[model samples]
Target: MTHRALLAATAIALAGTTAAFADAHTDSPFSITTIEYGERYLASTLIGESVHVADTEIMPGVALAAGTVDEWDDIGEIGDLIVGVDGTLQAVVLDIGGFLGIGERQVAIDWSALRPVYEEDNLEEYFLGLNVTQEQLEAAPELERTDADG
Candidate 1:
């Protein structure tokens, strides 16, 4: 075969192979209607809820001004969240016994013990109630640290 004709045939073969590979990975054939429904339902049910630890109210990433509730003025900000084995929110981890971010400990408070403050039908705030105080929080058990290797 002529050199030009041979080169043209090789080029066509390469193009066909490349097109086939591209077609295989392009898009999925399955429909995502159920996924969309689940996402919307979960978001509506779980989002927009707020949690109050001591005098501070929190909504995930948003942190409001820290204040004192009566004489319990030593409560620190929330550091993490604790979930139960049943996939429900169990407690809020609060940073306590610290001074200027030093010598702090995280302690868990019962989720049910937190007073849910609402506005209209939506959850707007939370209160730890008078039962909890800064002194008690400082004396509470410290959270155990776990390594990622576990």
Candidate 2:
């Protein structure tokens, strides 16, 4: 399949897919409230989560001709998330570069670039994948947010 087609398929598969996390609230603080699966994602838990490079064979104009999707080469980790006023996810600032607290810089990536990898209706063992490369990520501009920006 083409890259766009694969992204569409991934989106369709990921839509409404949820995961159950140990919540701290007695009244289900982060519950999505579905009778079938009852899954919810905690925003706080998403930080520091790793994002890997997804399938590249399907992608056109990419530097790599072939790639192992199963390998899931980690590109970066989530540092912060930008949310719109309407409660929509705008972008995710990823902490790229450096190792063990050395030279990490936050790069804001578009929310659409992330693809959730999971089984049918099962997000228990899923991970976030990106259709980008580590080199690209390293070369991207850093995202600096000021007090007025918020």
Candidate 3:
């Protein structure tokens, strides 16, 4: 099947599962209320955390702040998110360069490359340990999502 068809099928499957969950009235541990609470708690703990890049060569978890070329000290923001066919996070599209979206480039880095920082079981930040600088991402290939059959 085509990628677009596959994506649509995945979406439909997820919607059906969500509808079933919504219709469920059981008092099981996996109830919708419990799931919603977990989601809300996670969001409250992780929303404004910073995402940095680490140098694994020096030490295992040594990281540095990541941002645009102009605002090197500022925290990098997630521009978009890419998911796999199984609804798993695959990559994160980040804005690396340019000012106010003028000459910025959207680059997708694999989800595995990022390391989540947690303090006392609450997410506080994230670090990307690809050992590459902002210049590398600026010069790296851009990611484009298209439905056209190749």
Candidates in order have lDDT scores of 0.53, 0.67, 0.54
* lDDT assessment of candidate 2: 0.67
**Predictions: Cα RMSD each:** 13.5, 18.1, 13.9
Off by over 4 Å in 3: 1-50, 54-75, 118-130, 147-150
Clashing pairs in 2: none
Model 3: per-residue lDDT, tens digit, 13-100? 9999998888784556754454332123343333333455543432224333343222323335566667678968777766656777
TM-score of each: 0.43, 0.59, 0.47
- List candidate 1 stretches off by more than 4 Å: 1-74, 116-130
Report the C-alpha displacement of residue 125, candidate 2, in angstroms: 1.3
Q: 95-142 in candidate 1: lDDT tens per residue?
A: 666687798777777755544332333234333332465566557888
Tell me which of candidates 1 and 3 scores higher on TM-score: 3
Arrange candidates, best TM-score first.
2, 3, 1
Cα deviation of 10, candidate 2, in Å: 52
Better of 2 and 3 by lDDT: 2
